[model samples]
Target: MTETLADFRRRVADFLAHHGCPAGAAPSRSRRPADHVAAARVHQRALADAGLAGITWPVEVGGLGLGPEYRQAFAEESAGFETFSAVFTIGLGMCGPVLLALGTADQRSRYLPPLLRADEVWCQLFSEPGAGSDLAGLTTTAVPDDDGGWRIRGQKVWTTYAHHSDRALLLARTDPGKAKHRGITMFVLDMTAPGVTVRPLRQATGDAEFNEVFLDDVRVGPDDVVGAVDEGWRAATLMLMNERVALADNPIGSPVTLDAVVALANRTGRTTDPVVRKAVADAYVAQQQAELFARRIAGEVRVGRDPGALASIGKLAAGRLATQVSALALEVAGPDAVAWDPADPDGGLWAYGELYAPSLSIAGGTEQIQRTVLGERVLGLPREPQADRDVPFRELRRG
Candidate 1:
């Protein structure tokens, strides 16, 4: 008999408990990026072998061929523990599903298993310095090469784990004469190609979790295209939708939770203080509301509905909750939050959370972008006027 979702969850919890969770801080302290990536690969490989890594994926692609509920079960089980899932975030959450949605059979067969097993890692090349939330403005170009392949040129910024990735899902302008959002193409490119460069970008938390990637004459074959040429906007839109879904479901509200904040207040003897108490209560309410939004998005996904507008709205709510929780954590921790005792093991997490909280607004999509999406898509409001929406990309003026 096949294992049910509950049994699968129990088995996953047991394996993780027995084998030990991903080291609480191994990646941050690793001397080399390769070492950190290797550790993550090993843990992910173990998860895949245990039938827990790609619960919602087809069995032919190194998954259990289970439904989304099984994936949800695993997610719920794993949320309470530390896991080195950061390295696989793009591949599993966005790229893998996108491939499932638009990739040819050969591409899916060739890439999915290795990614699910963590033998290879992937990064997204979407945003550029000039076009983050407004990703359609990206100017990276992919021109036809002599060998019937594409030669890429330009830079990508804020790419997570690009420095350690083996492949990248790239978006580039294929026909600049078309409108900005049109004439774009998405392709899978080898990160190890001769002209590809990955440079780490350090964050406010002092961790180089993201990178700037430069591609010059990087070649990818016609077979590498993910969707119909010049129709990559559809693929990109789907990936961004998944990105919001993944980020929305993250339980770490600004890397801290209401329970943690409440516990901190109690430990600091501030729980009885009216101000702190009220903050905690309000935070609990906010987090709960955000969670409801997340659940609604998740339910849509589970039932084969596109998150659509809910992705934007849910992401905004989650970002706000995360921001609020981060503030509440700092208030509860008081002086100890910013500067921590070196001796305490959790000293870094609090400081890191405080520093990283601000990024929730920027990642996935900015708050303003989310609100705009909600206004236009969900509320049926007219889109704000744009000066260049219909102009040819090459004709648009840029700084």
Candidate 2:
């Protein structure tokens, strides 16, 4: 018999409580990739044991075989507590979905179960130094070998959690002669392989949450390929759409930050200051709007409908909202928001958020690209002018 939402929630809550998961504390952040992965693995194991992880995944793949509403409810409730699920966001939110959609039956059987249980963590290996916005212009190459495997050589930057990941979903060009988007293929790479190396990247906040990966002659078997060889562009597009949706739909987990800002205003007696009040109110409104927009898109996706251009709307909205809220946070905090001290009692969390806000606009896709997409696809505007539409990538001038 299927369990109701209420019963599921109660069971999850009880399981968490019984397992000594703390309640009502600030979410944990780790600078060490090993610590982050260890914590995430533990949490995922607990959730899987209790049938809470991968609630919407197929039961044969170590999931509960539930619907998206259940998944949404579980996420919402899980947001109420402090957890390390965010550490595995790329795996659970993006890679897993892509695998489910594009993976072969053997691939799914070999990968999905462990992923659902967090036995192996995954990272996205898509964006390159030259291919952030024009991802199709990526230079990563994969060549077929006599041994029935492919040799890959590439560099992927801004790869989140790569330093800790067990695997990567990699994109590379298999046929340079084909159109930019038509020559690509996606493969699941083992990060522990001898040809793979990951270097941590230090952010402004002094945390190495991101990494740069180098793939030097990394070999992958034919079974590692996801979807059709040349059809990977479509699969990648699907993964990216899901990524934008997930990012936009991320639940606000820092209510304490919001409360802290409000309390600071009240304590400083600046609640009546027109500028301060307006800033605070505006931040709140943006958050609410982002939440609503994300919820609507998620609901549509849950019902088996493609969100299409509305996914771009959500990504654009999230980028704007994150920037706005970070600015508001800094404005409210005044001088304290300049430099963060880890040892400081408040831990300078607001300052960190402020520093990290700019990445949101660039990470999944650039704000400019998203705007062009929305305008052309959603608003029925003319497509952006491209002078090199018919030119070969090799002949195109490097700007």
Candidate 3:
């Protein structure tokens, strides 16, 4: 007999209770970055061994082969724990899912098991310096070699956890003679390969959560190719959709909750202020609305239906909620929010989040990009004017 969802949730809660990482719900506590990553990997491996890592994935891929309900139970049970799984999010949530969808059977069998077990880490190499929103305009080039492999050369920016990655899901120009989107190909490249470099990028939050990756003639085998050579645009779009799901979905822990913000306000003696109280209420409603949108999208995906353009709705809404909650944290924390003394009781917790909140609108596709996508694809509005739609990428001027 199969284990039920309720039983699985209880088991997860028991495991989390015994996990020796950290205990309280405090967010201000900081640990060394390397330590956090290592701890996350170990915890992730333990989850894999327990058949709790990839809840909705196939057993062949080291998953429980259950469904979204099981996954939901695990997430709900584990949310209150002081776990560090950030390092695995891009891999298991975004890259792993996309590879499962687009990769060959050989590729899936070779990669998915190790990935699920946290034996390796992955990063997405999509955004380039000049191609942030217009990702197809990326200039990364992968040329075919006599050895039947491809030599990649380019730089990717805003790559999360790239400095700690084992492999990268890469998009490079393979046939520039074709249209911009048509000429691209997706390849899985070894991050530690010769001539590849990863540089830590400190964000406004004063943490190195992102990296700049440079690939100088990094080589990958034919088996590394995902989808057809020039059909990468399709795979890339699908990957972006998966990324939206990962970003918007509230599985695992939430970004930050309205309750936390209200509690902070109460702690700082702002709860009696009418304006502050109203802001708290408004933030709560926005969060609930976004949560509902995310749940709807996840349900659609669980039922084998594509979110298509609607994923943008979730991403945009979540981003807005994050920004709002973070701003509230700053407001409620008062002057101590920005300038914190160890003497301050709140411990300057909200400061880091306030700085980090602005990026929510920028990452995983910007708010502007999401709105444009929604307008053209979801709302049936006309696409923005493009004179180069028919022009071959080779003939177009690139800045």
Cα-based TM-score, every candidate: 0.90, 0.91, 0.90
- Candidate 2: residue 218 Cα off by (Å): 1.1
Between the candidate structures 2 and 3, which one is better when assessed by TM-score?
2
Once superposed on the true structure, which residue ranges of model 1 sit more than 4 Å away at CA? 1-14, 20-36, 248-252
* 21 Cα displacement, candidate 3 (Å): 6.1
Task: State the lDDT of candidate 1 residue by residue for 321-352, as single tens digits.
Answer: 87788888888888898887789867866677
Candidate with maximal lDDT: 1
- Candidate 3 residue-wise lDDT, 1-399, digit = tens: 778877887888777766635534323323367766777788788877766778888888788888777766765576546545466668988889888888999989999998988789898899999899899998999999998889999999999889888988999999989989899999998899998999989887788878899989888998889999988899988887776566544433234567777877766688789888888889889989987877888777665567788887776776778778888877777777778777765465677666666776777778898889888887889887896786889898878
RMSD of each: 2.6, 2.6, 2.7
Summed backbone clashes in each candidate are: 1, 0, 0
For candidate 2, the lDDT comes to 0.78
For model 2, residues 187-212, the per-residue Cα lDDT tens digits are: 99999998998998988667787888
Residue 326 CA error for candidate 1 (Å)?
2.5
lDDT of each: 0.81, 0.78, 0.79
Global CA lDDT of candidate 3, please?
0.79
